[model samples]
Target chain A: MNVIYTDNNATTQVAPEVLEEMLPYFSNQYGNPSSIHSFGGNVGKKIEEARSKIASLLGASSNEIVLTSCGTESDSTAILAALNSNPEKKHIVTTRVEHPAVKNLYEHLSRKGYRATFVPVDKDGNIDMEYLLKNLTGDTAMVSIMWANNETGVIFPIPEIAEEVKERGIVFHTDAVQAVGKIPINLAEVNVDMLSLSGHKLHAPKGVGVLYVRKGTKFSPFMIGGHQENGRRGGTENTASIIALGKAAELAAAHLDEENTRVKTLRDKLETELLKRVPNCIINGDRGNRLPNTTSIAFEYVEGESILMMMDQYGICASSGSACTSGSLEPSHVLRAMGVPFTAAHGSIRFSLSIYNTEEEIDFIIEKLPPIIERLRNMSPFWQEMKKKSA
Target chain B: MWDYTDKVKDHFLNPRNVGEIEDADGVGDVGSLACGDALKLFLKLDEHKRIKDAKFQTFGCASAIASSSALTEMIKGLTLEEAKKISNENIAEYLGGLPKEKMHCSVMGRDALEKAISHIKGEEEKKIEGEIVCECFGVTDREIERAVRENHLTSIKDVTDYVKAGGGCQNCHEKIQAIIDGILGVERPAKKEAPKLTNIQKIRLIEETLEREITPTLKKDGGDIALIDVDGDRVLVKLRGTCASCSKSELTLKHYVESKLRELVAPELEVEEVQ
Candidate 1:
């Protein structure tokens, strides 16, 4: 069975080019960059090159980029550094729809003597900017928000938000883990103080991430250890993955146009065809201001895990924001935060595409998915009740 | 992804009896859309009270649909009295075993079956027997206690996995713990004859009482307790962080700390502030 992988938001396939670029670092070039030997010193130069490539992709300075283990580390370092730099500020601001990386960290912070203000989102998953502005107080140490929602693929207005947050002297951070490669971001033009990007979200292997700290931003190290990442982040770098991330970043930059055009077209086609074929289904996010390669469709009355399982039978990989899929009692926080109806929230399926995805894959999914939804709906008591009510 | 059994996968992929029985003798619905899973069971009974046909319409995950399917198959030929003997464990065992978190799916099947049986007997639907313990899932104390006793659940998380009692806001965790303790017959305090206590013994008991009983309750409110000193019956302590800032720390110190110490150590034990 040919697997049609569409769960890119969860993680993407490591690009072959990225793997090839990283193999030498694991074997022949296996020198600790921290060592003073020439072999190690040469490896240090390669690390710098990788940093520059990643920096270029984000429109950031090479010195501003600090490589960490993953996006979660980058988020923790940024948020903690902001709070530590200004200890007098006891408050933090974030959106309610953040991925667990930011959401769970903020929840932990709230328990640890920090007042966290979770700004609400609209029904379309658009952030309430007025609520955000009102919550930005002198006591707010930082405002952390995501660039794009992983579940809904809804893009937040980061540039506008960053400018407003910066004007108030509040440190602004954006977890751009989902948006960095798929969307066009120029941190040179944006006023965000800190930005996080993960490797695996953009075709690089996992365990490598970049925290872009704007120049002149006050800093404190989260992982206090040996002077590495210029003491901004500590511990020996994940060398091979770092190199792979650099290659991935370069490819991402090159493929950015294709991502917006061809990938977006495929995603739109899949979403459109599914909606056309399947009745009583609704899209979960702002269709206009979303990532080019993602769609979250809720087949009302049917459960998401069942839909995902049925899709799995056909070798079509996807993900769900539903409760059963997450092992939680409620559906995805993103959907609930956006006030998606309970009827739809439990059945939301997210299809995130990547550059590797083809039109045939999308077509295959379009062909296979509607019947699955119809079958599940046929078995769903809620669906039957709904049909009767409508009748 | 859940590690579903092959039996579970087979049942889910090719679910049996997947529709409502028209003019059914008994019908039962359990769960809701808000809860992320629900099952509607329909039963057709013969003159001898044997199940002529059984069908289900389920809106849930693989295990839920599979459990519903399995239930219909299991109860098809059984008389109402025999069908009433089926348990959530029996349903789960039918499908090899459901993941612990997905155990509630099996429970849902059993609930629907019970309701269907009750409906056939023309009995009033079982009223929610106890106070609501988990507001998030609307799981009542009776429901939680029954699941705990039946499943032999040992932890709050296990109870949650079986019946979704303390799975939400978790404000009722302490209450759930009390209910579990009540069923398991584990005394919260060791009530042996009070032994003569050395200063060291008293201090150790105070620390143990604070760590075991008082700290967990305080920590739930984002507060903490520290044993500053233990001099005789007057257990001197300090509240930290949220506890220090909380205006109700006095009540916490008196009502919570003193009462716990009195019960666990001695009735005459007193707690006082060091700061």
Candidate 2:
């Protein structure tokens, strides 16, 4: 069976070009960047070159970028550094719909003598900017928010938020792990104090991420060890992944136009046709201001895991915010936070596309998905009840 | 990403007895849309009181649908008395075995079967008998106790896996633990008698109690406490951060902190704020 990979939000397939670029780093060019020898000195230069590529993609300075193991590390380093830098300040602000990388950390902070204000989101997955502004205080150490939500693909107004946070002298951070490659970001134009991007979310191999800290931002290190990442983060670099991420960034920059045009068209077509064909289904986010390559659709009355299982039979990969899929009793926090009805929340399916996806794949999904939904609905007791009530 | 058995996959892909049994002798519905799963079981009995036909309509994950399908197949030829004896374990065993977390799917099947049997016998549906424990999932103490005893569940997580009792908010973990302890017949540790102390020993103990018992809970609410002095039976302390600004600091000190100290230390001790 031919694999139709549409679960890019979870992780993307590593681009072949990125793998080719990283092959030499793992074998022939395996010198530690920290060593003083010429062989190692050459590796240090390559690392700087890689850093510059990633920096260019984000419109940031090479010096501002700190490479870490993954997006979670970048988030931890940013948030913890803000708290540690201003130990006297015991308050933090975030949204209720953040990725666990930031949400769990904020929750942990709340348990450890910090006041955490979780700004709410409306049913369309739009944040309450007034609530966010009102929550900011002199005692707030940091405000961490995601640029684009992982499950809903709803884009937040980060630049405007950053400006407000900076005016109040509060450190602002954005988890752009899902936003960086798919959406255009010019950090030089935005006043964000810190931003996190994961390599694997694009077409790079896993286990590498970048944390961009503005030049004047107060800094404290999370991983205390030998001098690495300019002492902002520690341990020897994941050399191969770093190299691959650099190549992926360059490709992402080149493919940005294709992502917005072709990929967006495919995503829209898939979403539009599925909704047209399937009865009683609803989209779960602000359709206008969302990531170009993602769609979250909730097929009412049928469970999402069952839909995913049926899709899996045809080698079509996708994901769900359903309770059963997450091993939790409630649905996705993003859906619940947006006040999506329980009838729809438990059946939300997220299909995130990548540049590699073709129109044929989208068409194939459109053909296959409606019947699956119909079949599951036929088996659902809720569906029968709904039909009977309507009748 | 669940490691579902081949039997489970087969049952889910080609579910058995999928439909409503019109003019059925008994019908039972369990779970709800809010709980992320629901099942409706229908049974048609012959003149001899044997199940002539059984069918189900389910809204759930693969294992749940499969469990419901398996239940209908299992009860098709059995008498009502024989069907009443079917346990969740038997339903799970029929499908080779379900994932530990997916055991609740099997439990849903058993609950529907029991309800259907009760419906046929003209019995009142079992009322929620005990106080609600886990408010997030609306799981009652009776439900938790029954799941614990039947599944031989040992941990709060196991109970969650079997019945989704402590799966959300988790405010009722301590209560769930108490229930599990009651069922397991584990003796509660005997309370240690308060040790007699000199002035220095008393001060040290008071400080230790504040640090170990009182401070962490206060910290969770963005507050902190400091031991100022221990004079006679009175323990003086200072509140900081949100506690200092809070209108309920006195209540916290007199009720929460003081009560905890009295329980852990000498019962005659009185707590006061230095400020």
Candidate 3:
């Protein structure tokens, strides 16, 4: 069966071009970049070339980017570095809707005797900037927020927040794993001290990520080992995935316009047509400030897993912020934080499109999904009670 | 993705008897909107009061929908007495079985059937019989106990899977464990009240605890510890055997020896590694 993949925010398929660029590194060109031999020295050049390409994607210099295992490691390195370097500061601040990479770490840090404050969000998944700013004080060692939420795709105004945070003399970082390629980010203009991006989110293979550290930012290493990544991260380079990430970054730059236009249109059309066709449905995030490729929709009185299961029969892939899907008794914390009701939170489906998605795939989903929702609603006793109440 | 059986997939994709039976003898409604799943069962009886038709409207996941469809299919042509006897396991067995996490879907089927039968008997749905344990899911102690006793559930996670108890907030996990241990006849080690000990008494208890609790385990790794002297709360020790020259001997002394001594003998006792 032909598959219509729309769950790009979860992870994208490795672009063919990236795979082609990485093929040589996996086999014939397997020389260690740290080795002194010419074969090894030549591969080092390719690693630097890949770094420059990734650096160009974020408007950072080659020296500023330190390759790491993944986005989670980058986040840990950045936060731990800030806290360790500034031992006098005892508090750490972050938004409530951070991905587990940052949120769980902060919770763990709080248990380890550091004060932690998670700023709340409004019903539209919009961060409470006032509350975030008010919580920042002289004691805060670092402030780490996200550029775009992974589940809801609501983009935060990082540049403005970075400037505000820096003025307070606190180290500012953003987990731009979801935002790096989907949205335009020029770190040259943004005052963020640190930024993180995962390769797999932008059509690169997994196991490779980059942490862009601004020059003159006080730093410490998370991984203490071999003097790789300029002793910033010590793991032997993930040669193949790093090369793949470089190729993926180049492709992302070339396709940035198409991603913003065609992909955004497809995402918008899917949301508009789905809402129009299905009743008792509402979108989850702020429409104006969200990532162009994402739309989280909530269908009331029906569960998300059932909707996703029905969609899967037609080979249409998607994701949900539902508790049943995640094996948690409660729905997604992001949705709950936004005050999405239990009725809708259990049925929130996220359709995150990429440049690979087409108009026809959106049309197919638009045609097939409404009936599935209606079918589930028909079997829903609440739906019957709702109609009776109205009648 | 859930590895749903072909039977589950079939039933979920095409549910049976999926509309309200308008002229029904009984209607049973269970679960709530906030709980993420609910079911309404409609039963129609024959002239002889046997179940001639059964229909349902459910709001949940694949296993839930499949279980509802399977329940409607299972209860047909059975008397109220026979239909009421159908268990959650029977419904799960009917569909080749559900994932352990999705077992609540089968429980939902059984609860709806029980409610439908009670509705026809003109019984005011009995008030909840026990104190609520899991506040997140509104699960009760009696329900949790029954699930543990029936399913031979051992862990809090097992209880949660069977009855959705201790699945939320986790404030009631200890309560659930108490209930499980009660049913399973397991004696829990009582919380030891640390009695105040004199200087000599504390030192003796520390040595006793080391011999009885710590020595046997340490001997497994060719390691041993000898108490030097006790100065107030500090118990200095000499690491012997393989632990004597080990690089992590200090770590073992502080992390393992001190913690065990503190926990078992006296909370104030500290272990220091000495030559």
Candidate 4:
């Protein structure tokens, strides 16, 4: 079956080029970057080169990049480092739409005596900038926000928020796992103190991530070990994945325009066709100011897991914000935060495109998805009542 | 990603007896849109009180739809009493099995059936069965107790799996656990004397035990395992992650895995490894 992969926000396929660049590091170049021996020292040089590639991608100095295990680790490192640096500050501010890496951590921190204010979002999945600005106080040690939401693909104004928070001398961080590769980010122009990004989201292998800490930012080690990553994040490097990430980052730099144009057109067509063909469905996020690759659509009276299963049979891969798939009793925090109604929230499906997605695949989904929704809606108990009432 | 059985996939892909039976003898609507899954069942009975026709309209995941379809299929041609005897487990069994978290889908099937039967019996709609326990899911205490009694659910998580009792904000987990303990305490004597676990029940127990009891511990040690097949008293499993490569993995299997399975699933069961 020809699998139409559209769940890039979940994780992406490792690009063949990225994978190729990484294979040599697994065995032939498997030496400790920390060791003083030339063989190991040669590996260290490759690490520096990889670091530069990542830094170049983000418009940052190589010294500012700290390699970690994954995005979650980078999130933990950034948030914890901010708090650890300013121990007196007892408050944290983050949006309700942050990925679990930040949101769950803030929740844990809330239980541990730190005051966490979860700023709300509008129905369009836009952050309530007023609430966020109002909540920033003298006691707030850190303000962590996501540059793009994983579920909704809603992009937050990271640079603007960063500037405001930095002006107030509050440590600012953004989980850019979704935004980094798909969007053009020249962090040298933004006032963010720290940024978190994962490798797998950008066609690199998993288990490797980067925490870009602005130079001279107050920091404490999350994984304290050997003097690796300039002691900001400490662990022996995930060499192959790190190398893969560098190549992926370089590719991302090259493909930024394609992401914005070709991928965006495919995404728009899927969104437009599905919305036109399907009834009682609405886009969950803002039509504008969202990541080019994502379209979160909610089909009322039908459930997301069923939609996904039917799509799976056609080799269509996507994700859902529905509670059934969430492994909880409530729908996604992102959707709920946006005040998306229960009718729509239960049926929300996020179709995230990538550079690999083709127009044929989009058209196939456009052709096939309407019937699936109609079938499920036909089986929905509410659909019967709704039709009867309308009649 | 739900690991739905092929039977479930078949039913979801091609659900049986869909749509409403207008002017039906009994109509039962259970669950709400807020809950993420809802079902409405329509039954037409023969003059002899046997189900002549059964149809359902369900709004839920694949398993929920499958479970509803399975219920409609299973209840047709059965007398009201025989149909009443069909439990949530029967609904799940009809589809081979459901993921533990998804057992509530089968419970939804059972709930819809009960509601339809109540309608046939002239029971009042919205007659609160018991005090609402899990405010989030709106699961009732009677429902929890009944699920526990029938399913032998041992923990708050089990209650959540069976009926979604504590699968929310978890504010009522303590109350749910209390209900579970109370039910288990009342049923302990009868349990020892009850019939031995059926193959389906035994497999469910082992899988639940693995998920609730053993998987977390193994995961803490950077390892995991999958139950391959159950052959009479022998349980086959494949160790994974750190456990797959560890020298003491065999010991881990015999001492940890076997003991845990024996304690929770069945005493006579043996653990074996398959390549």
Candidate 1 per-residue lDDT over residues B125-216, each given as its tens digit:
88989989899999899899899889999899999899988777889998999999999998797556767778787788888988999899
Model 1 CA lDDT for position A165: 96
Q: Model 4, B4-68: lDDT tens per residue? A: 89999999889999987877889888899999999999999998999999999999999999999
Give the per-residue lDDT of model 2 (tens digit) for B90-119: 999999999999999999999999999999
Instruction: Give candidate 3 misplaced runs (Cα > 4 Å).
Output: B191-275
DockQ of each: 0.67, 0.69, 0.65, 0.61
Error of 2 at B246 (Å): 39
Docking category of candidate 3:
medium
- Candidate 3, A332: how far from true, in Å? 1.2
- For model 3, residues B33-91, the per-residue Cα lDDT tens digits are 88888899999999999999999999999999999999999999999999988989999
Q: Model 2: per-residue lDDT, tens digit, A236-337?
A: 988889989989999999999999999999999999999899989999999999999999999999999999999999999999999999788889999999
Which regions of candidate 2 are displaced past 4 Å? B190-275
- Tens digits of per-residue lDDT, candidate 3, A1-391, equal 8899999998999999999999999899999999999899888888999999999999999999999989999999999999988987999999889999999999999988899999999998888989999999999999999999988899998988999999999999999999988889998899999999999999998898999999999999999999998999897899999989999999999988888899999999999999999999999989999999999999998999999999999999999988889776678999999999988999999999998888999999999999999999999998888999999
TM-score of each: 0.88, 0.89, 0.89, 0.86
- The regions of model 4 sitting more than 4 angstroms off are B186-275
List per-prediction Cα lDDT, in the order shown. 0.93, 0.93, 0.92, 0.91
Model 2 lDDT, full chain set: 0.93
In the order shown, the candidates' Cα RMSDs to the true structure are 8.8, 7.7, 5.3, 14.6
**CA shift of A261, model 3, Å:** 1.3
How well does candidate 4 match the true structure in TM-score terms?
0.86
